[model samples]
Target chain A: MTSGLFHVPLWIELVAAATGGIQGALFAAGIRDRRIDVLGVVAIGLTVALGGSLMRDVVLDQLPVVVSSEWYLLVAAAASLLGMALQSVLTRTEWLISLLDAAVMGIFGAIGASKAVAYGAGSLGAVLVGVVAAVGGGVLRDLMANRPISIIHVGTLNAAAAGIGASMLVLLLRIDVPVGIAGPISAVATALLRIAAVHLG
Target chain B: MTSGLFHVPLWIELVAAATGGIQGALFAAGIRDRRIDVLGVVAIGLTVALGGSLMRDVVLDQLPVVVSSEWYLLVAAAASLLGMALQSVLTRTEWLISLLDAAVMGIFGAIGASKAVAYGAGSLGAVLVGVVAAVGGGVLRDLMANRPISIIHVGTLNAAAAGIGASMLVLLLRIDVPVGIAGPISAVATALLRIAAVHLG
Candidate 1:
């Protein structure tokens, strides 16, 4: 267990990981100009699924849960492979890709913020960690692919949406709200903002 | 003290950080085509100076010395700013840049391997950490600049030289060599190898 006071349910965390893997794989596959091989694509997918967790644990000075737990790696790898297989069929479904991306960002952001709160970080610090965790993997992906960092280059509200979600979670925890209630609210809010931005544009 | 068994001297670590800062700033400034602002150049400089140490500490599941020690940040930032100021004068001194780059990699690699050994990692694991610590910052810099990763694309012996240095340190430690002696030897060996590759090429 991560902590006695706060922990995301295993199934919920797994779902988030799975979606992250799929979304990352699909995103990597969409980059056709680069000479990214199959293995490269899969690696990017795994980064999306686990890189943020590794970064979060490292920043907190703890062993990464991704490395310690066998299930996370196995699930992420499987989901990444599954995503690769499905990419051809889903190539045209841009909305679905956007939805998964937003959902993954939101879920990861909330989890990161909640963990920071449990670790007793100040509100701003917790929110910072949450935003990093939300966007770290995408940054890594862009780096590996030699592409511009999406959060920095795109005028989209990706990081702002994550910041809002993370801030909300931190605020909720400050008032003694249970993590269970606050976490989902944070995730949904972030996802909606992101989705709204994309749809409106 | 990082550990009772082994630790790099504060002065030695500072020198490495300073060199890394200088090298990183020079490297960033050389990319004239990119629209990197002054702050961007300095941030990249800081990344090269501290990113590897951050990665190494995170992998070892310990708090980053770069964060905990005031000296590291101060020295790195000052060195980065100094490097930026000297860029115009040093623009033609390509050899100096390469030398600093090699030396920084070697020093960081040796320190990382030595720390992992002190932390009771296996030989391979220690060496892996060393290579990552040596090359991690450069990778991040390239990523930020939207360039192909230098270590991966350059076909140089950068990673190999670092691996050789780290492995040598691990071997010396296994035979009960004092870290004080082993560390410098490792650093020198890595630097020479890298320098040879550049000159010979």
Candidate 2:
């Protein structure tokens, strides 16, 4: 099946969506404790999913992928809805959110870097954009939800994880790996690194 | 006279700084009402000054102007400090806050568009970046302070003001107005348009 043939890339993006959703849900839930509403939650969710890419595109002087790619919006929204629906499930699996958060942060960073390279920017520029894209969404999400951002917090290896993932993705893409495949690999690297750091740090 | 030699541009930027500070203060004050602390207010002030320019730079793959230029950070901090200090004095005059907000918003937007043009992007891209630069700061400020963003609010002329200012600024740039002179002229146009909009709209 054509779907089967594209399964790897598709699955990776979906996983990204799921992770992003969970992150958004956590943000919303945190704010809900302070009495923020449903609309605010959705905005935070959507922003966390697309904010970095939007910022990336704005910086690059390109048409915003957030506005241009319909899939981006759909997948992000679907993922957040899944998060909202599974709130009870997440509560029981406390460790899962952290794992997913790490993974999502990594993949988004990798994708941002890889895409920047594909667009013909320098490797260094790609790396910087990657990190920004990775962490940026979460930053916006937290801000909107009225929570302190995760990046600036002590003992959080967010930038470290994003840097490693983005660097790996850019290197892989530079060497000519199909980013569709290499992208997920970098995401995993990012997630695993974050997890390791989370435990170690 | 020292005042005469001080020139119009210096006075305008000072006015701009005071205006921007009040708006930043208002947003930070609102966030404080919701229980965020001192760091939250500082972050919001920075966001109001730098968010748009940073957004524009990151997308363009350049080091953000906020980081590269002393003026951006200095002005933002000064405005924020001014705002924090005068919050009580200005709070009673809500109309003053509204007017200052309108003026600062307009000026920033014009500055963004002009900067984008200087960066060698296309006209349309410049216009978009300009608008982003103008409003990006305030939107980020609101989000950081945990308040409602004006961009998504109904019947808000936020973007419209920036768009018009951007168009004018971009148009003037195309005619080759010196970059230094263009910034203040465009800022004035934006400020006037915003003031007009408040009365007319």
Candidate 3:
């Protein structure tokens, strides 16, 4: 019975994990100048998606969320595999990659901020954690790829968009809007912001 | 009198810290892309030197080493400038960058592993911590720069080198080797292994 109510968040989490994984795989295969097999691709992808959250939990003196939760692992892996399959079928388009990156950043930023608040971190700390968490997976991927981080030096509006989106989400929560709506709203805002930036560019 | 004994470690730490910083700056400059500016270069360098240590401390539930010590900041900053300066002079030799990277990796692995062990981690845990600490900073830089992590999925000897070097250091320490010699031995081992891998490559 409890599982019924829990499925919504569970589904979201799984999707989020998969999104992260797919991004990582693309980066490894494309940027790193190597062909990552299915296992390597999946491992890298899932690690990136969950790395930030897992790192955050460990830093906060909790068991890493992915390690402790079976659902997180299963969902993340499934989602990544799904993404890999989709990417295989879909036409390779630069615009699509950009859009997905932006969308993921938005959702992740909200996830980070909300998770921080859930853990009772102060606002400033929450923001820091949120930003890191949102971007953390990408950062790990870039590191593996032997390059500089994308958000920091890239002329793109990545971090700025994420911060703004996160702020709005946190502000809404302070006023008691339902948590469920906040995540998607913030994610959409981030996605739109990035997509618009690219369009305007 | 007591402060003098403590000062010894601090002095050694300064050299290690600076070495790390300079390595970071040079790594950034060596990328052959003129996209990053001075601020980005320095920032990337500094993060590589400090990021892993900070993450280690944060995860271990202790105040970060940078937060507690002023010298860490100073050494890292100075080394970053030195690295940039050195890169300007040394870019003629294409392979020196790799050598510098291996050197930094070894020292960091040793330093990180030793610190983790001191914090009451088991031998395996300490070795793992050390490898992470050594490479963590560079990983951060790569990510920020949107590059791949040098440790994972790159088929490089980075983590393995770190693991072996740190584990040896910890083992020597446990067997009552004087603490003074352990640090250099581990760092040297790490550096040599990295350099040897480059040669084999």
Q: Which candidate has the top score in DockQ?
A: 1
lDDT of 3 by residue, B166-194 (tens): 88888887887765688789888888887
Per-model CA lDDT versus the true structure: 0.80, 0.65, 0.68
Candidate 2 chain B weakest lDDT stretch, 10 residues: B1-10
| lDDT, model 1, position A158 | 78
Interface RMSD of 2: 7.0
Better of 2 and 3 by lDDT: 3
- Which is better, 2 or 3, measured by DockQ? 3
TM-score of each: 0.63, 0.55, 0.57
Docking class of 1: incorrect
Model 2 Cα lDDT, one tens digit per residue, B35-146? 7566666666666656666766665456665676567567778777766667656546456666776777767676556555555556665676776667777777666654
Model 2 residue A48 lDDT score: 69
Please report the candidate that would top TM-score against the real structure: 1
**DockQ-based ranking, best first?**
1, 3, 2
TM-score of chain A of 2: 0.83
* lDDT of model 1 at position B199: 74
Cα shift from native, residue B188, model 2 (Å) = 25
Question: Cα deviation in Å at residue A100, candidate 1?
Answer: 6.2
TM-score of chain A of 1: 0.93
